[model samples]
Target chain A: MADRSSKRRTLRLKTPISAEDIADFRLGDVVYLDGLIYTGREGVYKRVVDEGAELPVDPAQVGNVNFHCSPAAAVREDGSYNVGAVTATASFRFAKWLDRWFEISGCKVIIGKGGMTSEAYRKHLVPQGAVYLTTVGYGTGALLGRGIKRVVAAHWLEDLGIAQAMWVFEVENFGPFLVESDLQGNSLFERANAEVAKNLDALYEGLKPPVMSRYGETDDRKDELI
Target chain B: MISTQTLQNVAEELMAKAAIEIPDDYLAGVKGMAETEEGDLSAFVLRAMLENYEAAKEDRRAMCADTGVPRWFVKLGNEARIEGGPVALEAALRRATASATHEIPLRPNRVHPLWRTDHNNNVGLNAPEIDYSFEPEANWIDLTAVHKGGLFGTDYRMLFPGDGIDGIKRFLLDTLIAFGKRGLACQPAIVGIGLGGSKDTCMVLGKQAACLRTVGNRNPDPRIAALEMELKDLGNSIGMGAMGFVGSSMVIDCHIEAGFTHTGGMPMSVHAFCLSSRRATARVHADGGIDYRTDPKWFTPYMRRETVEWQTDPASGARSA
Candidate 1:
């Protein structure tokens, strides 16, 4: 069932999202984060997790939220990264590292598109005080306009290219992010899927099969709900 | 003859438009969905999406970071005359991509697939994947540039002939559900389905349907058109609302196209496009006239499907229930 709340507001947050702050969030809650957030994705994760390289920011000061993104920017002649657009990429491929990312980076919130796939992340999250928030897939422009305030520090523009480098941003009121996975191990997506399965069952409940087997299918597909 | 400069300018303008701005049709669809969305969260998300589009346009900033690798679908007239021909045209497209990277400034998305070396200019071997079609009597060149988003990719499936249309429908629904499970590929998705043909051809048609077709358009084949409508309704009913928030308007549109297939096998491909649906079209005439349009008219050569008629209420802007 859809939440019928007519009024929606953004909850402004400070840096280092505490366990209490994240635990208070329910699945589907909308919030705005204003503080220091570090960005990392496939390339940085590969370097940190697989290659055992040291991250530039110390785990303690990197704050609670870590954005999973490969930002788009034009490298200026002065060597500073200009903010063109910053959008979340899918975080499923890096699912194995979700817990480790929290452990190593001390970030309790992971911001990315297409929520985490690994059930292991859920299990790891509850104890470690973490959650997964989903940015609107097409809200990248809004993210650039309002979410990101400015680029603070950047590493690996030369080594990893503009898209994959680790960019630290000073963000102000940075989200209308949906809490896809909460600290309680609850996922809005899992609930939605359960509903979808029911809807699929109901859709095929009483359909009759066509008289002619248009293609030469040996098996009878009449009324079988896939 | 179309000069090298003309081709380059057309490419640059189209790519820039596609990268930075949300085409008018897609914006209308998003607005319509926002009006009709059943879930509050979905509605909120839809409005946010519209704001994003507006902000990007007003700021002249690239909407989403993944300005995507360019996918060109070019239709050349038989009577078309050019100075350097296809080779020159290809060179112009490549150069435009490089130029646009700095102007609209597209994200350098092209990376060496195996070696992971970044091209930094969005140009590599077969960088801008280009496809061509020829119209024998026409004397113009029509190009549709689709900025294929780098978020997720097209879904493909091949089945034996015996599996039938039912199997195909199930595959599509299942694929959509899976996408929804993985946060629903940016919400209110535009689903493109390809039926029949070989693996690659079906995938191409699906891409065309997703990237080229407009929101309210229908397929020409009656049966296929009916399937399109059914899938659109069914997929929405799944309630994977904006970004997997449970809601009624999960999909904005479903575009399907079919081609002749082999006797032994059936191929069905699905491509899910985010609400952004970035695309732009340009037509260069023999008289040196150039026209730019948001609509690609991919189905211009095909027939219109006559399925069930829908009546809309003007006051409420709602289809008759």
Candidate 2:
């Protein structure tokens, strides 16, 4: 048995767990992780790469990487955990710089919502042996439920707030999520979109309104509440 | 005495319960259509609807509470894989959502022809909403579970939850224009306008607007944020009630994304909101796996039921008391 109780794991880089190890993780499976990972999102990443300052992280300790947007924006002087829900947002603007994010953080798994586009998935993902995945959308509260504590990198807190906070946490489980994009460049975005278009076209062509609509002949619309 | 945590839990349990209780108003709309429409096509539509209702009833779920807004935007990662069936994603979504509606016994909000009726569950204009955005990630996919808020008109609320929001639309609209004007930081040019409902339908346009794919940020530049800030103030000034009558933040927080204006045209729209803001999310790994990524730091057990009970005062409701 893995003696699940006593293992102390720090937030590390995105570790390359084989398909065998990772496949076991389900949409709602909880797992304690042990590895090195860097933490950076929008503003956090900007400070590190843009400022060219001494890395707040101990390069030797970082194993993998984690990314989230709009994390806790305010710094609490008392050191009590500042709770928040996080999700990946608007990565299109940063695609050009994505490869660098991976290289710097050595992240194998980048978690975000909305499947990525084709070009970015292929060029940046496959060659690097990286993978991408999606979670249910707007599930903020349920998603935020997993945060256990704050393992602050000390100085990093001063530098980053919402976009750059380096707060590592112990997650309960990785959930009942599905893969939309893969190392081979397959994408859910393209597939889901095609289905939408097809459905829309069918709806437009098939349904027609009756000469006398059901809600009565009068068009007393303006006064109605929304 | 409901704390934020208690409120959240109540929001989840009772609201989810309400979702299951299919309202007569919605089902009535669907039933009314089944006997009237003519032709094989009508039959086809009727059959599809039957299946949807069946799934909802059997599973005790909602037909389509527009889970898409949360599912498409919240907990998603870079990739997603659906293996259960060859059924198209959209088709499966419709079926699943329909199942949810029927099971939850939620009111069917979909209606026909411009007059939106809560017949059965077929509200017009794709009553269910979904939004999307680009994302990046490792192998683990993310799934966002959301408890969305609903804004119904003040009237006909007893008839259906969808009806309560109608009474507040005027105040809401007035607030939107005020936000874009000199009163707020809103710059007329780069706005994404959302006009809900066809002047007549009981359908909710504002809630739909909130679910719409945004044109851009409510504030990209300082000018935009300033406009948003000003609007917030002015909107409250009108004294719109709790549902915008006595006045609250009429536009909520004008979230700004980035967008370009067409010449001098100031674009803006009214966005309605679901009340709960109930949603959840999780993530998948590189090999097509997931980590039900709940931020443990915030997950308190308070949401769960307790043995103790509290008393309520005569204040009935002191405005969110």
Candidate 3:
């Protein structure tokens, strides 16, 4: 009732994020996440869904946001997990099972690099009341340097390598993340794609004939043949 | 003669530099893109990237957590005598990688592709990928190491003969668009397009172009150079912006290298590196004097062998002839 459409909000959210909190977040809204967070990726998803292994930590109780990241985090000789140190990989590869990750992990929000698929948003995300957010790609060093405050816990050390283990993080001002997918079934990626495609014709028109014709026929000629 | 000690030291320092510092040219490219980029979203992301670079350098930490697999391109002088043979040079590089793992505290990224096994030291079978080219007249060794992350799409590619320049452009554009839409490739991306060679030749050229060439360096061949500039503009026009948000600074530059192809077919390869664009260079002379370089003279093979007499401006991050 608080002018849900136009009343924009910037939230600094903590863990055990409630349904009431996620409801305020719409597609394209940027949010800063703090408190408890955890990471997973293709391998972790496979392990959870395919192998039926229990996640070492439960986001439903402790953390409400999950990150689809496979960080290159190695422990030092002291054997302590390097807290707040991580590298974020691309998120699109894990698009297929993101909804399932949300279901199993009970995380209300997810963070990754690329935007999630429209199908995932439409079918699984909307019904389940979740969102997929995107952080800046290759901004790993910066994210850890400034955003992530500490590493709380890690699990599945022996079964999954350090890269694939479940890591719970305590973050401070964790993001200016773009909400690519939301409970409303809207996706920023799908919308941005359509917007970009509208300009493709204009872009193609600017391309001159290949500098020196080598193999293929000219575009003008090809049009006639077709 | 360049001793094994010199080789190992240079390699170790280069690896540390590759992880800790973003090269000057790459930094300039990012700043340039940020300056000209439109849209508040693009501006915000680019500013964050610039800040990130500064933080990494100041903190003496890797700019990115995913310090990718260690890769080295070595130009060995034929005349230069080594304490051991080529195998010694290779061993020095391997030792440097392992040492840098603890020294620079590089994330041990080497892992078994199938078994999901992590080699904590970032060394193993064919781990630190080294490509060697022997120069007959040279008396020194020049090595450049680049860290290729998992997110930067593909490091190597092959296209059929039917894919001419038009098809090649189409492939490059399509691939960038597809991956970039997913926020992969990490724009403003640096693309290396290698054309007209066997698969391996083109792949190597592509990798070199992406990891070696600086953003503003022109290809020696005028025609190829013109294409490189054209591709840079075209790629930026796609509106992928900093992190695939709508804006103007999608690509920092596109570097292309061409070699003579088989008459029957045309092969093309593309190597894309994310904005982190981490690389470092060092030279080991026969007299045991060593020098490290901020500007990697990878394109100018002849000049790399000769004594480099260049001045660098820190403010603009530019190199003068």
The TM-scores, one per candidate, come to: 0.87, 0.38, 0.86
Task: Give per-residue CA lDDT, model 3, range A95-174, as digits (tens).
Answer: 67766677787767777777667887777777778877777645757556467677687777667766777777778888
Which residue pairs overlap in candidate 3's backbone?
A114-B182
Model 2: how far residue A151 lies from native, Å:
3.0
> Which portions of model 2 show Cα errors greater than 4 Å?
A1-38, A72-77, A147-155, A206-226, B1-321
Q: Give each model's whole-structure lDDT.
A: 0.74, 0.36, 0.72
Q: Which candidate leads the pack in TM-score? A: 1
Which candidate model has the greater DockQ, 2 or 3? Answer: 3
Model 3: residues >4 Å from true position, as ranges?
A: A1-10, A58-61, A95-100, A206-226, B155-165, B301-321
Error of 3 at B81 (Å): 2.4
Model 3: lDDT equals 0.72
The alpha-carbon RMSD values of the candidates against the true structure, listed in the order shown, are 6.6, 24.0, 6.4
Docking class of 2: incorrect
Q: Considering every candidate listed, which one attains the maximal lDDT? A: 1
Candidate 1, residue B5: lDDT:
84
